[model samples]
Structure formats: structure tokens, C-alpha cells
Target: MTHLFSKLSLYNSARYPANAARPLLEIHVLQPRQVFTLAAATALAPVAIDLYLPSSVGMARELGVDAGAAGLAVSVFLFGLAAGQLVIGPLSDRVGRRPTILGGLACFILAAGVASQANSLPVLLTARLFQALGACSVLLSSRAMVSDRLDPPSAARLFSMLSLIGGAAPVLAPIIGALLAELGGWRACFFFMAVFGFTVLTAATVLLPESRSAETSAAARSESPVEAYLTLLKNREFQLYLIAGGANGAAFFTYLGNSASVFQDVYGVSPFAFSIMVALNAGALVWANQINRRLLKQHSLLAVLRMSGRNAGLLAAAFALMALSGVTALPLLLGLVFLMVGSVAPVQANTLASVMGIGRARAGSAGALLGAAIFALGALASSIAGYFYDHTARPLTLVTAVFLAITSLALG
Candidate 1:
């Protein structure tokens, strides 16, 4: 039987003269198809997470639920996403990446359909949970696939790009969802997501080459799953990265959970305008990623961590100060939010990779745990943010600042 995880020849994306030794500054090496598949697969989760943001208010209105109650749908979805990874990661270890991903995609599509037709808040929230459960496969498999095939340096570069692509969805999803909502209402947004999921599912069947082997997976399966997890948990570095990544994940969820209220209710911005703010914030992430790539050429991953940690701490302080100053103006809040997330976003990929670099077999489980911790904490943050959602920016900014500060301390 063929082993799909076997390393392929390095496909160099750059060429230089024999004497040229400087690292290439640009990332044109990932083939068009590789980029597309990775982007689609990895980006699906963020898209699922954010695509409903703009529709949250509409869904609440249509379902006759309060905004806080409707926000439970988002929280439930994230809860499912976090829970799904715990099982899916190990299952992928047993089955293979391709089967895991395909199965998850199928489930996600079904959930989307259910969500589109949901008649009540309970039904919608339930469907969103299932939707999140299915979407986890897409993210886990993509990261696992990269780990299986790419060398460390190449893996870092590709994963950075993957993070960038993943970030783009949140950057644009609110706008996209808002546009759909404006045209045909909240249900129409689900229809759009369903179409996107279906398209990706079809593409995966045709385009995604299998990257893990059944025989190896089967052999590994012979070991006790408990032992496997315990072994990974024993790794000290993995703990560090997990905590670091989880901190940022917490911060991100804080943003997601509070952005709508902060923008519309606190600052009196329109939904369209709020989406623009999200775009700007996400755009900062993209810029940070670019900077991260450049720093890779000159600094070790640890060096990057130190920088990111400090920056996160500084921004968190800024958030706290901003919240206390009673400056709920859109421009002031936007600038602060952008600064806080901008530096934190790019460092996340490196944080995960540093801790999980032992070998490929553990990547899925590790990434899953990392993701689970982040999102689980994020869900907690979301709940807290929502609970404290007075018509002020203080709750949101205070949460962001606190998370960043805590993360910095932990990472430091």
C-alpha cells in the first residue's frame, strides 16, 4: 500500500544564480493549486465562524430573540468547533487526513442546510453547533496535511500563508454576510455558506491529494489512545506554545464576541461600518503576517516569540487604558483594536509550530489541542463579554487587554 505521508521532492518556488545565497523575500513558491486547496481548506473554519457576524442582529430580530440570546448561536458553534477537534484529531490519526476532512465537510454542509431552514433560536443554535463540529475537520486536516509533507522551514512558510488566508475570511466575512443579509436576509447568508461548503467539498474530492497513509495510521492505532495523548502532553514546549496560542485565541474571541456591540451600540456605527472596522483589523493581521515572514529570514522563531509577547503585552495595556478613558469614538477604538491584534496575529503560527515540531504524527493531535484550548477559552471569553455588554466599549477592550496581559505573562 502507498504511504501518502511520504515526503515529496522539494519544489523550489524561487531560482537564483549559483552564487546567490540570500533567502527569497517573496512567497511565490506555493503552486497555484496548493495555495488554493490550503486556503480553501484552512479558511473554511474562520469563514464559518465569521460569516454569521453581520447576520447576528438580523437573526435575532427574525427569531424574536434578544441580541445576547442570539449570540448564543455563535458561542454554541465555537463550542462545537472546540469539542469536535478533540475527537476528530484522534480519529484522523486512526483513519487518515483525507477521509477525516471529507467526512467533516459533508457534515458541515448538512448543518448549513439545517441552519438555513431553522425556525427558532433553539433550532438555529443547535444547527450552528453541528455546523461548527463539521467545520473542524477542514482546519485539522489541512494543518495535518502540511505537517506530513513539508520540511520545517517550508512548513513554517506555508503555515504562515495558511494563517494569512485563514485571517482573510474574518476580514471579509462580516461584509459578505452583511451584503447577503441586506439582499435576502439572514437565511440567505447560510445559503451562501452552503454553496461555499459544497464547492469546497467537490474540490477536495478532486483536488486534494491524499497526504497520509492508512497502513501507518492503522499501525499507530494499535497503541493506546490515552498513551498517545499523555505522551504529547508530556512535552514542555508544546505546553508553552499551546498556552501562548490559546491566549491569542482568547483575545480573538473577545473581539468576535464584542465587536458588534462595541461598534453599533457603543459607538453608533452601522453594520456596514462595523464590517469595515473588522476588515481594517483583519488587514492589520495580514500586515503582521508579512512582517513575520520577513523576520523569519533574520531571527529565530524564539526571537519572534519574544517580540510578539512584548507587543501583545503593550497592546493589551493600551486596550485597558482605552477602555477606562471613556473614549468610545469609532476612530479611537478602531486604532486601539487594530494595534492590539496586529502584532499578535502573525506570531500565532510560529507559536504553534515551535511547540509541535517534534514530528508529523503528533501535529494533528497537537494542533487540535491547541485549537481546542484557544476556542474553548474563547467561548468563555465570549460569554463573559456578552454578559458585560453594556452600551460601552469598556467590556470588550478590558477583556482584550486582560487576555493579552495574561498571555504575555504566561509566555514571558
Candidate 2:
């Protein structure tokens, strides 16, 4: 596995000699505007997924769907995310990043409009699927673009910083979603998605530079899709990171998909208050990712990942215990949730850098594969949690704990 990554490093060094990297880094690495583009691109899918969460119950009622059926909308969106990455990843490798992203942005804008006008559950879910598809394209391309310009160490730092910057969306999304739902109704959330999509499209068209080099593009074109994925799949260590990342994603998304329900329905918190609690947890993610960036200066990526994974697993177990104990302590529950959420960036950022570094030859495909693993597993976890909801925190906490336990095993 190390040899595979080493060969890629050597491949990069030959084409972009170390001396060239400084200038390239100056331009493509975390520059202020580029940071915004990348952050927004990465955050789009999450924002789309989360922005309407506060309205899930309302949307269900309006559409005449059961709670479980409404919950399946999120799971379906996750599935679309996974599928889109698999399709567009290889396409981006062939077509270049800029155009692929632009095309996807158009799709997102169109889908968001469609979702806004949805008259039924099936219509809403279908529109959400296309929305996920577009969001996944932008996401995989942003990830691949970083790998295109930087090696693993630099990429790790950039990813952490990027997450910190983009972390703003997660913090604000629910609050904004709640406010929009209150003022204009549930459809307003989807309307906002369209407007936001258009804004990003314009920014990306004007500001985002093409990072995929001609040499890399040719190399990508030379391989068939089957060969490319086979190259990635055959690496043992990559498989470990995939499992670790996927498990971490599962735990986080399960908690994400259901926490609003638990906090609001069980505990009787208002939508605005629930959003504030989510914001605090999101702030923990930003803080923790910055800490991860600092720790990487001294520790190996694998080391930081293992430690975070262990801590997250413990915190998740505690979450389950608290739920089972029937303790209604909001502050204590949110504290554990904050800690559990904090672990996400370190584990995911490191794991992503590792896998992308290993398959840097076809970075677009590599990123897509990792994203697919994360979201596919996320969809599975959300489905299981949704199935056992029981109007309590038990389903969410139990799913989170089980997934994090898997994460610890993979990272350990």
C-alpha cells in the first residue's frame, strides 16, 4: 500500500518537481477565494441534505406520507449521492474538473427548483435524488482538485482547514432552515437551495481554476473505468481507510438524521433551540479539525485518525447508555453529542487524504470511490435508524454506537 502511494508521489514529483510545488501551492492551496469555492462546493451537499430537516415532519404531513416514508427521503438522497459519485468521478477524470462541476451545478439548480414545486412525496424524493446527484459531482470534483495540486501532507492540512471554513454551513443550515420554514413554509428551503446553487455556479464559472493537469488527464483517459476502479480496490490499506471513513460517516449521519426528532419531539424543544444545539455541535467540529491540523505537525495521519476513532467510539457508546438509562438531561446529552461530532473531521480528513493519495493517479475516481463508501454506508445507517425510530433517541444512539465501534476496529 505504501509502495502504491509512494509510486504516486514519485509520479507527481517527476511531473511537478518539488521546486514547482511552491508556486502551485501559492495558487491552488487554500488561497482565500479558492478556499471559499472549495468550502462552498464541499458544503453544498450537506446543506442540501440538512437545510430541510426541520421541516421533515411538516413536509410529511403536507404530502400525506408517514414519518418512516418521509425518513426514506433522506436515505434515498444518500443513495443518489453515492451513485452520482460513481458515475461522475470517472467522467471528471475524462472531461476535466471545471466542466464537470459546471454541468453538475446546472443540474443542482434545476433540481432544486423542481424540488421546490413538488406536490407529493414521490415528486419530492425524485427531485431530491437529482439534487444529490448534482451535489455529489461538485463534491467529488472539489476533493479531486485538492489532490491534483497537493501531496498527502499538504492535502491533509488543507482538508482540515477547508472543513473548518465550510463548517459554517452545518452551523447555520438548520437555523436558516428553521427560520425559512417558519416564515415561508417548507418549500422555502428548496427555493433557497436553487438560489444558492445559482450563486455557486456563477462564482465557480468566474473564479475556479482548472487544476487537472494535461499529463494527469491523459493518464486518466488511458485507463478504462473497470481498470481504474480495480486499481483502487486492490489496495489493502485503502480498504481499511474506506471502512473507517464509511463507518464514521454512518455514525455522524445517523445522529444527524434523527437528532432533530429526538430533541424536538421527545424533549419538546423548539425548532430554533434545536438548531442552536446543532450549531454548538458543529462548532465543536470546526474546533476539532483545527486541532487535527495542529496535531498533524507532530503525529502521523494514521495516529491521529486512530485516536479520534477510539474517542468517538467511546463517546458513541456513552450516548447509547444515556438513552437506555432514560435520562432526560439535555446538557449532558448535547455534550456527548458534541464530542462525538468533533471526532468526524479528524478521522474523515485523514482517511480521505490517505485514500486519495494512494490513488492520486486517477484522483477524480479515487475521491468518488471514497465519497461513495461514506454516503452509501450513511444511507444504510440512516435507514436502520429510521426503521427503529420509536420516537426516542435509542435508535439514533444505538446506530451511532454500532457504527463507531466498526470505525474503531477499522482504524485500530
Report the number of the highest-lDDT candidate.
2
Error of 2 at 282 (Å): 1.6
What are the TM-scores, per candidate, against the unseen true structure? 0.90, 0.92
- Model 2, residue 182: distance off in Å is 1.4
Residue-level lDDT tens digits of model 1 in 208-302: 76666443376457766566667777888777778788888888888887677667666667878777777778788788877787777688777
Off by over 4 Å in 1: 1-30, 213-219
Whole-model lDDT per candidate: 0.75, 0.83
Model 2 worst lDDT run, 10 consecutive residues: 21-30
Model 1 gets an lDDT of 0.75
Which parts of model 2 have CA positions greater than 4 angstroms off?
1-15, 18-30, 323-328
Candidate 2 has which clashing residue pairs, if any? none
